[model samples]
Target: MMDENDVKELISSYKNIKDRVEIISNKFDRHNVKLVAVSKTKPTEMIRILYDKGHRHFGENYIQELVSKSEELSELNEIKWHFIGSIQSNKSKILTSVKNLYVVETVENKKILDKLAKSLLNNEENNNNNNNNNNKKLNIMIQVNTSGEESKSGCKPEECLDLVKHCLEDNNCKNSLNFLGLMTIGNPNATPDQPDFKCLVDCKNNISKQLNIPLDSIELSMGMSHDFEPAIEFGSTSVRVGSAIFGERDYSNKK
Candidate 1:
């Protein structure tokens, strides 16, 4: 329902945020920090506008909405959809069925991980049967509840290592799921020196050493529209931003 003026504003806002992220990344000597434009309630036309402008990475927080958008935008071959919301156990099959689903950034337990891996295997087999042989493994990140908030959907900081080990070593998961990194939703009121961010950073470092992988290999997906600048400085490789780029969401109509 965005008019031409709304479209213009969206693009301008997106570009401004993108440029700011790049500037902060450059200032801190961090390169390749991905800006996942969080498009949960936004319309596909707005997404397509950004897509046409060469912004391929988009994130959705709800499974049904994500599936719809992925299908609607299926023609855009290079689109990378990041699912940043909580994963329900029964929804794994429907979620993995989504085409161009680049990563699921809210994996917190072995159950969800196993289900996703199985779904990915089935999807790959289906693709092979159809002579479509691009068998790319889906990327997954462990969500660490660094702030210890009961409302957040992530594993405790201490539990992350074991979960990550299971992800890397389990036969079902290793084959279809790529252990990309750790993700977190920190305390909303915390400042730049938020201990939640530091806790997540520690989780990444511990996982890297315990698993014998390089530090850079484990991406930290922290930060949002509010504190992305500090997040980049705190070694966040991927930031999920929503309202800053798309304007405030009108959640009234959402069920």
Candidate 2:
């Protein structure tokens, strides 16, 4: 249960985050962008308050935390869980099994794709037998390394088109994985028109044209606490902001 102080803080954080998103978004044509409250590392009590306050979308970076939280918050059927971290082959099945998993935003290569394919294939069979057509397919986003950062887990900008093509058309896994659009962690210091964000915009256009997919139908998932405003200006459909909404993370126990 949240104490008075905790409740106040959560309310303040949610309002600030919402206001910023609206203020920035009003300047753009596409103001329908989503605000993903990144609740990774934060406790469910805190997340619950935000959920109670009407923020249904939450993002998690780790598998264990996401699964456990989803189960814990099972009563709130409206919560949308987003897996925003690197995909591990070992954890693919667990990911596929997550209920209310609205989107996976970090698909980078063929190996992870193959593992996910197996899990999704199993899901298809199970759903087919059960006549559960509503949950047959899953939404997927290609994570492109627009910043060209070596440490980041994303496909290189040049490699993104083929990865997209593989997911959208050529791959056998398209039935289960609906390749929606693209995502990128733009360079923190770069301007909206610069390297990272620009690459994402350009890459999406090229790929959509190449695949004959309507460019407008593709969603761009970019921006975070420090850079969402510019990301909105650059056509980001959703911004993942954690610290700004959940306060600074408690990293004392983190490795």
TM, every model: 0.97, 0.94
lDDT of 2 by residue, 1-255 (tens): 768987898889889889988988887766689999998888889888988888999999988888998989889899999899888889999999998999999999977777787798888788879988765678889899998879898998899888877776645578778887899998887864667887899998998888888988899999999998888888899999999888899866431
Candidate 1 lDDT by residue in tens digits, 179-248: 9999998788996578999999999889988989899889999999999988899999999999999989
- Angstrom error of the Cα, residue 71, model 1: value is 1.0
Q: Over 4 Å off in model 1, which ranges?
A: none
Predicted structure 1, TM vs. truth: 0.97
The numbered model that scores best in lDDT is 1
Give the alpha-carbon lDDT of every model: 0.92, 0.86
